[model samples]
Target: MHHTASSHSGPDHGTPRTVAAHRQAFHDLLAAFARPENTEQLPLLAALGRGLAMDILAPLDLPPFANSQMDGYAVRSADIPDAGAELRITDPIPAGAAPAALETGLAAPIMTGAMIPPGADAVVPIELAEPDVFPVPGKAATVRLPPVLAGTFVRDAGSDVRAGELALAAGTCLGPGQLGLLAALGITVVTVYRKARVLLVTTGDEVVEPGSPLAAGKIYDANGTLLEAAMRQAGLDVLRTGISTDSPDELLLLLRRHSPAVDLIVTTGGVSKGAYEVVRQATAAQEVEFLHVAMQPGGPQGLGRFDGTPFIGFPGNPVSCLISFEMFLRPVLGTLLGSPAPRPAVKARLASPLTSPEGKHQVRRGTLLPDGTVRLEGGAGSHLIHALANSNALVHVPVGTSALVAGEEVEVWTL
Candidate 1:
C-alpha cells in the first residue's frame, strides 16, 4: 500500500517506515524489474569493473614451462660439486627463445625469464661464477661456479596455476589484476554481466540548469549532476534527460517515454507532501508507493514502476537526495551488480555530543579525522548540501538511541 502525502516533515508526523523496511522493499522492487540473465563479450579492457559471467579455466600452465628466475648460469647440480669446480659454458639463452638441452657437466647462461635448458637442473647467478659475465653465444668458455641445489632459482611449470585449473571463478568482479590474469592466459575476450542503465530525472520549477543564469528564487540544478555522478561512480550507466517541470503530466510523460529503454528511472524531488509534488501526483495513479522512511536528511522516498521499469524518487534537497541514494539505493545496487565496491565502514568516535530524534535513523555528514574521530560538518538540516560536499564520511545514528556523548563510538562509512 502507498502512503498519502502529508505536509508534516517533523518527527511528530505519522509513523514512518524504518530504513531496513524501505531497503527490503527496494530490493523486491528491483527484483520485480529484473530482466533476463544476459551476458556480453567485452574485450579485456572493457571488462574492468564488471562481473565475470563464467568461470575461466587456465588453458596452459602459468609460465608454461620451467624458466630461470634470474640472470644466472643453468647447470646440473651434480656438476657443481664445489665452488672451485669449473664447468665449460655451452650457450647463452635469452628470453623468448627456446633453449637446447645442456650437455652433462656444462652450463648455459640463461637470462631472467628464459626457459631452462632441458637437461639443466639449477641456475647459479653470474656473480657466483669466476668470470662474472656471460660468454659470447658462439664462444667456447669455462667458468668456476659455486654449488647450487637442484631447482634453485627456477620457476617450475604450473607453479602458479596448472593447465585446466580454475583460474578465475564465476561471478568474480573483474578488476585490473583479474583482467591481467586473463590476458596472461591468452584470453582477449571475456563474458561479463551488463551494467544496469538508469534514467535520472530532476524536478522543480525553481531548479535551473547550471549554465543558465539564476533569477529571483531559482537555484542551480545540483541533484542532476550530483546523483548522476554518484550513480555512474557506482557502475550504473546513467542516461540524463532535461529537468522536468513541476507539472505532473510533463514528468509522467518523461518517465513513460524513457522507461522503455532503461532498466530503472530515478527522480530527484517531487515525492514529498509539498503542493508541487510532481513525482507523487504523476505516479499516484500508477503503482508507485511513496514512503516516509525513518531517517533524517532523507525521509520522503518513492519506489515502484513506470511501465515495468523500476522507479525510485528521492527528496529535492541536495543533501537528502544524495543520502537517500547512499543509504537506500547504493547498497542494493552493489549486491545486484557485484560492482562499485561498497565503501569502507569503520567505528569512529564522536568528536562532540549530539542528540538525534528518537525512532528515526539520522544520517549526518561529517569529516572523519585522522585521530579516529568524526567531526560533524553541519547541523542535521536536509538542505545543507555544502556539508555533504565537505564530508568524507557518513555517520549513521541508528533508530532507538537519542543522544551520543563526545567520544562515543559510532558506525561510519568512509566516502
Candidate 2:
C-alpha cells in the first residue's frame, strides 16, 4: 500500500488511514505503553468482569464428599440385583447429614445432596422406588426398590472439580458462569488484573454541564458523560474531571495533576483540525499526533503518550466519541487486558439502501429486527447522538463499496 502521510518514526503518525489500519495503530500505541502490570484481590461479585491474574486452584474437592444425586433410597448396589428386592428401611439421611455404613439388605432414605453412607454406591429416585412416597424412617417394615447398577445417580467426590486442579486459568474473564464456578469452589476472594485507570477530559468553550442555564453559545457537556458511561460499561475504571476546559494551558495543567494517578488519559473534542483546538494545540510539542483517518463520524483522531502515560484524543462530537471508543479503544482493551469481552461481528440483511463516501469506511447506526434485518436509524451525521442512543447495532460500509441496496447482506456489530 502507498504511504499516505509524510515519513514518521513509527507505523502511525499524522497520516490518513482506513478504519482497520487506524485501529491497529492505536492498539500498537497502547501495547507499547510502559504501564506496569498490576493485580488486585476482590470479592467474587466485584470481580465479575475483571481478568484473572492467577490460575485459581480448587481449594478442595467440589462436593467435598460423595453425595446422593437423587432423593431416594441409598443402598449397596450388590445387595439389590432384582427389581422386586425388598430391604429394611433404616434412619433417613437428609442433606448435609452424615450417616453410618449401610447394613446388608437395608436401604436408607437419602435426600438429594445428602452425603452417601459408607458402602452405599447408588441412589434410586424416590418416584421410581416402590411406594413412591418415602415412608417414615424405621417406621415402615420394608421398602421395595428396583435394581440399580453401581454408581447410578451417585455424585462421586470431586466429581465437579478435584482438589489442586485449575478452576480458572490466568487471563480468564470472570463472567457469571465463571464466577458461579468459583462460588461453587468456595472461593470468596480472587486475584484479578487491575483495570486501567483512565483520566477522562472533555474540551471546548461552548460545552457546559447539564442543569446550567444555557447561554447563547453553550451546549450541555455530553462528551464527558457519553465516554465515561461507555468506558465504565466496558469494565474500565474511569476517573473523570468535573470541569470542561477550552484553554490549552488549563488542559495541560489538568493532565499534569491527574497523569500520575492514572494509567491512561483520554480527551474528547479539540483534536480535529481547527484554529482553536484545545487538545491539539496543548500537546503540539508533546508525543501525541493528530490524524484524519479514513473513517466517517470519527475521521479525526489522536494517539500518543503524555509524560509517559498513554494518551488518546477523540473527535469532540458525542457520536464520534462513542463510536471511536467502540471501534478502536474498546477492542484494544479486550485484546490487551482480556476484560470487556469483544463484540461479535455477524452478517445481517439491510432493510434499506444506503450510500457511503468513496474512500472512507462508514459506520451507520441501526436497530436489528427480530427477522434479522437491520433498519438504519439516522443519516450519517457525526453529531447525531440521539440516533446513536436508539441504535442497537452498527452497520459497516467498508472503503471499496459505496452503495448497498436493500436486502443485501452486510457485516454488523451488535451493541
Task: State each model's C-alpha RMSD to the native.
Answer: 3.7, 3.6
* lDDT string, candidate 1, 208-321, tens digits: 999999999999999999999999888789999999999988887888888899988899998887777888888866667776888997888887777767788898999999
Clashing residue pairs in candidate 2 (N, C-alpha, C atoms within 3 angstroms): 269-316
TM per candidate: 0.86, 0.87
Report the Cα lDDT for residue 149, model 2: 91
Task: Please report, as a residue range, the 10-residue window in candidate 2 with the lowest summed lDDT.
Answer: 1-10
TM-score of predicted model 2? Answer: 0.87
List residue ranges in candidate 1 displaced over 4 A.
1-18, 32-36, 82-84, 346-358, 367-376, 397-411
Model 1, residue 36: C-alpha shift (Å): 5.4
**Highest TM-score scorer:** 2
How well does candidate 2 score on lDDT at residue 234?
85
**Model 2 misplacement above 4 A:** 1-15, 32-37, 242-245, 344-347
> Compared to the true structure, candidate 1 yields what TM-score?
0.86
Residue 138 displacement (Å), model 2: 2.8
